[model samples]
Target chain A: MSPKVSQEHMEQRRAEILKAAEKVFIEYGYERATMKHIMDAANVSRGGLYQYFSNKEAMFETILEEGLSLELDETLEMLKENATSYWDMLMKTIFGEGGEPDDEMDPLAPAKLEFFIIGRNDEHRRAYGKTRYNNGLSIYAHIIEDGQRSGEFSKKFDHEIIARSIIAFIDGLAVEDAMLSREDLRIKEQSVLFVEYLKMALGISEHSTDGK
Target chain B: MSPKVSQEHMEQRRAEILKAAEKVFIEYGYERATMKHIMDAANVSRGGLYQYFSNKEAMFETILEEGLSLELDETLEMLKENATSYWDMLMKTIFGEGGEPDDEMDPLAPAKLEFFIIGRNDEHRRAYGKTRYNNGLSIYAHIIEDGQRSGEFSKKFDHEIIARSIIAFIDGLAVEDAMLSREDLRIKEQSVLFVEYLKMALGISEHSTDGK
Candidate 1:
């Protein structure tokens, strides 16, 4: 009889493969990066990789879904704690800690943009992209809604509108970051400047002393 | 003897080919798009097409350069006239007049993004992308600096920083716009909302009461 692979072992193997797939995707991008590359990078057989993900789209969806869910869970936990101020929490959620808005491009930045832009023409990919974008927007809008209810944020602008703006600003910066030099893009500095714009738009009375 | 084509006729034919190339690029995107597609769309022989442009890159560069120059000249003329409010002129320059922010995706949006993101991996393309980005940034930055100097806009934030943020926001919105439905993205309304954010950041005192 063949040895039964435990569920935990399968999960571990899946995670390991995903880590490798991420690397492959980042290096070669969506269109050019093939399953052969993933197999080589992950050190998995064709049968093994196929068992986990039928194709590149499935693999990419799983990767993005996993990353987003993890992020959402963390943000949700932060919301429940309610220890941090709304603005601080929002900034942390968006930019993360110890992020200095420097010139270092997210290694996966090119892949991420390539995936969506190329996906534009594909119906299946477009549907997945839309669902993912809406999911992200909801998380952000919820934070703003919470702030407004607590009177920490101004009621001047719609929470959903403000939330979408955040997405736009970040995405726009990423587009520029992908194309321009760090010196020219000045992402970190631009992000700092964007935070100030956020403060004004959200009608936050005072600026946080942190994030500098 | 072969008939001589005048320089004007040659220039006109080149322009015609570019227009068709734009359509082909929009349909197939940058990577998948082929010179044959452009030739078929333009109804020119491959030889004829090659006479004007050595490759897809040269064709794309010519198209983009023409667009930018036309836009820059119009904007410079606006600055000279100085009739419009700085904010209005900036918005017009960035979004264009009569742009309704509807669901009609910029047909070129995907190709434009694909070109730059893929360019991230190619050194020659990367260098060209950076130069193009800086040129665009300077146009916007110049508008803001002019505003600050003229006392038409407040200097609350660095003009360059503000300019970069505008690029970031627009690019970010385009990223989302390319992926999501117009209704889901809320681009038109969000753009109007973002103008409010811009006002707050720039310290523009009164709302324009336009673009409603």
Candidate 2:
């Protein structure tokens, strides 16, 4: 009984460390971010941090696993809830909260891109990256396939293709965000625009506010 | 004079070095690629190569400037030719030679992505990356604006937004290409499908071969 309680506490502590480490990685980027910075950000001693993660890479992999999979699970759950139209659900799954523009981009985007791009030359990292990317692609494709079955989306294009395009657009924006200043890229506006493009491709009626 | 002949020969030698360096970079990637690999690939002595480029980064920057901007300039010239429809011209500008599906992906994509993603933490690199990205965006936007003025494309959405979407989709594919194997992502097919999506968004007629 004591061991079980301690295990639960460790998991909670691990989550806290990941949360803080993500912020530090975002601010400083992956190459510049250090284990010391993570320890400082998490407000944990080196011993405490190392107890959960072996190194910065281990901490990053943990963060990515949690962040990427959690979002996928949440989006899938939203699809299952059936609270809105399929199109609305798709948009919500993508943009969150009625698909409105946000003031800032996802803070983790830079680190995420860094991980995958730098991982290209590494066999282990490349394999892991492929899994995460395919998982991401499947989530969006699954939503579109579901929408098609429900007659909410057009059958003009393959659902898989459209889903891939969505990934491409989102990934492209993240790439731009990594290299360019926020003002130069207009990430939010570009997202809304891509959503509009999705509507056209899916044969859905355009929203009045779209493209304005 | 012999000096004139020597200068022309030197220009030819520099071009040869860059071509070989590009091939080496493609195979090993930017981080893993060594100066020795370039020296071997180019068949130039270390002293001979150093005369042209001070370092690997310098070699890469020269390659990028020539490769990226030269393509941009060529596309812009194609747009000016007026021999093709605006949509066809735009497609050619993007995918080359009428947007046909090719057997292979862009060879330089991995290195280009590495340069920019790794640049996120470096001020000098980050600045150059932004300029290139924005320059790429504006080229697309300029073509779209021109098309709209000629009534070839409906001004349904802001041209700049569509332009950004184009960047996102292309960039996104590069990101996916960097991480996932070619078979899994189907980069060529995705590009073709995306062109179909752009057709719908732009209110153009669908081609029979589209979205296959």
Candidate 3:
């Protein structure tokens, strides 16, 4: 029989399971990673696993939320606390150049993409696109508008357009990282090089952020 | 009963079906736009549809090929047509934003993105990204390496990194266009805005290609 752990112990167990789950997902890709593997990795019984989470997706969702939340909080906090212009800190975050690297990614992205691509059928991709388009964009749009109103940025180009472009840029970066490519793109210098290109692209300097 | 038509007429009918398929995919989103819907819009028998294409995915692939082949061909042609600075025209062709407008876009982009994102999980997204990355970027990398050799752009940065970033930037633009709140983003002005931002990022003369 599975051990009858207390509630506190169960919560700790769930965290441990999720921690293992993240490693499996990263190594195997979401579709290929099996429940048996997760169970073995987590060192939990079948019934025990069910008690803590409903399914693989629920487990992933929790990990995704907690992981991305931590990463986003750290990235945004770095940007906000630095008191540098949005452009500089944004590029730095992308490069993982400065401050502590809180997991060099937003965890929800690959899973969100895999959901659109792998899960469901034809009816799903379109619906997912609509939702992805809506939810993925609004927060950034609000952020851009705030930057503009506060005079931290300019209103020369369409704020929505800039926001969407930046969203796409970040998305593309995540895709780069997700690839099982022949080239070793994960090294620190390579990553920083890419981020510097983005910095120049956004005109992130005190010289150019003057509404240039 | 199916109506008989000349070979030329049948070919024209096939073209019409693919065109309608594009609209159908975009209109209903990729997943929900069924073969039945596409048949109704394209005025093709289900048998005829199957004859031209095996499934919704096949039809989507054909539509993408029809739309984007010209742009890709043009990029390759421009690369070899002259001994001019390949990097300069490279920006113009992909991101610099000069093209004969069709419907509401530069024709190649909106549909390319639509089909790619629709097939984000299919062999198509992988194929599309691979073909574009391998062929287009392999060519651009050559030019950047040449520039590095000639000591124009910085030799301090990896030519491969810059080439990939530029490709990612262009891909990111297409993805942004593919997924955006329509109210916030206007398709007509997208190419122009993209070019402007690209020029700023690259720190090039505002009118480099104007006299050419």
Candidate 3 TM-score to native = 0.62
Tell me the TM-score of model 2. 0.89
**Residue-level lDDT tens digits of model 1 in B1-212:** 33456777888898899999999987898888999999999999988999999999888878778877987787677656653667777866777663224434466777788888877878988988888877877888988999888887889888988887777777787788678766777777787777776777777766443523
In order, the TM-score of chain B in each prediction is: 0.87, 0.89, 0.66
Native-referenced DockQ of model 3: 0.20
Q: For residues B54-170, what per-residue lDDT tens digits would candidate 3 score against the true structure? A: 998778767656656866676667656643654465554554234322114233444444344434355646666556556666666777677667644446666676666656655
Candidate scoring better on DockQ of 2 and 3 = 2
RMSD list, candidates in order = 3.3, 3.6, 7.0
Instruction: Kindly report the fnat of each predicted structure, to 2 decimals.
Output: 0.97, 0.87, 0.22
Give lDDT tens digits, candidate 3, residues A131-195: 65555466556655666677665667666666566666666665554442435333344345544
Per-prediction tally of clashes: 4, 0, 1
What TM-score does chain B of candidate 3 reach?
0.66
> lDDT of candidate 2?
0.80
**Model 3 - which docking category?**
incorrect
Model 3 lDDT at residue A110: 54
Evaluate residue B130 in candidate 3 and report its C-alpha lDDT on the 0 to 100 scale: 57
The lDDT, on a scale of 0 to 1, for candidate 1 is: 0.79
Q: Model 3 interface RMSD, in angstroms? A: 5.3
